[model samples]
Target: MPKHLNNQSSSVSLTVAAMGVVYGDIGTSPLYALRECFHESHGLPVTPDNVLGILSMIVWSLVLVVTVKYLLFVMKADNEGEGGMLALLALSQQSRPVDLRKGLNVVVTLGLIGVAFLYSDGIITPAISVLSAVEGLTLTTDVFTPYILPLTVALVALLFMIQRRGSGTIGSIFGPIMLLWFVTMALLGLHSLIQTPEVLRAANPLYAIQFLIRHAGVGILVLGSVFLVLTGA
Candidate 1:
């Protein structure tokens, strides 16, 4: 291939890979995050105000934590060309003051703990994402309801089996699928927005503030739930 075409192809591949691997968790989060906010345990009433408030919280969390914090700040912390908890830990050890060298154990421990959390999330996230999607079949027909667990298990197992093929292969396979899923969701959301344009009012920060003030204790719980928006992003 020509040089410019090669560069374009590489860029496109990276973009697709990011959409598949990075966005997948965050994409599936909407499946259960909003529902969790209004679960019976939360005692959250599904009034229009409450709905708008929750939406506002989710929107802001994504903007601040994912967009601003991760994209702008965290992305800058890469060690050389590498990233992730281990890479940062290595970078920190190299850059630390001589006086702080004695505390290396503590730093290493903290980094290891962060790695453990990532591992746990890796295990839990895939299972939950697949199961939640499979369970949606229940809403369409009762026939699939009974087999939901089995189907989820089989699908998840297939995912793990494919893992041996490596990230590049997985990305090439999953990228277009996730891309289509996101595009479909965007269209659906746009259709809904066209019908209820007032929902856009949730974009204001005041609704989130008002929600916290009115709900008080419950608002804190909902805030934790809203943090789910940052899962994959």
Candidate 2:
């Protein structure tokens, strides 16, 4: 291939690999996030209005927080081409003036705290996601209902077992796997939307605002559940 064609191919490959590795969690989260909002602990009703409200909140949260804030803004704040809380902290410290050194210690301390929370999240997110997925098997066979916990554990263990191969190897397959996953999800969502096209009205922000006003305490719980969709992002 020509040099330009080779460069283009490499970029496309990297983009696909990135999709598989980086987007796996966020992509799978939709399986459980909306359902969790109506869990007994949240006390949110399953009424049409409430559902619309929750859906609206989820839509806007992804648009504003993930697309606008993280993709557009935070991704630009990299340290040596790496991005994360620690990278942002290092970049900030480097760009600070000498006069600001007095408070640098405090900033570093806070950054460490954020990193600690991130570690905790990494441990919890996979467990929750796998468990939720395994739970879905119960709908197909009642036998799975009894084995849910064990199956979840085994699947998660196998997932971690493969991690030794390193991210580069995993990422190479992730793009195609995630692409198939998303396409399946989109088709399922479209099928449901066809049955109830009115649900599209949830795109309005007013539904979210009205839901918050009507539900008050329950709204908090719904928002908490909705926040899960953003996890691993």
Per-prediction TM-score to the true structure, in the order listed: 0.89, 0.89
Q: Residue by residue across 62-127, what tens digits does model 1's lDDT show?
A: 999888988899899999989999899889879663355465577788998999988987887788
lDDT of 2 at 89: 79
Question: Please, what are the lDDT tens digits per residue for candidate 2 over residues 38-142?
Answer: 898876658999889999999998988999998899888788899899887777778663355455576777888989989998998999999999899888789
**lDDT, model 1, position 136:** 86
Candidate 1 regions exceeding 4 Å error are 97-109
Candidate 2's C-alpha runs over 4 A off are 1-8, 95-106
Whole-model lDDT per candidate? 0.88, 0.87
Clash counts for all predictions: 0, 1
What's the TM for model 1?
Answer: 0.89
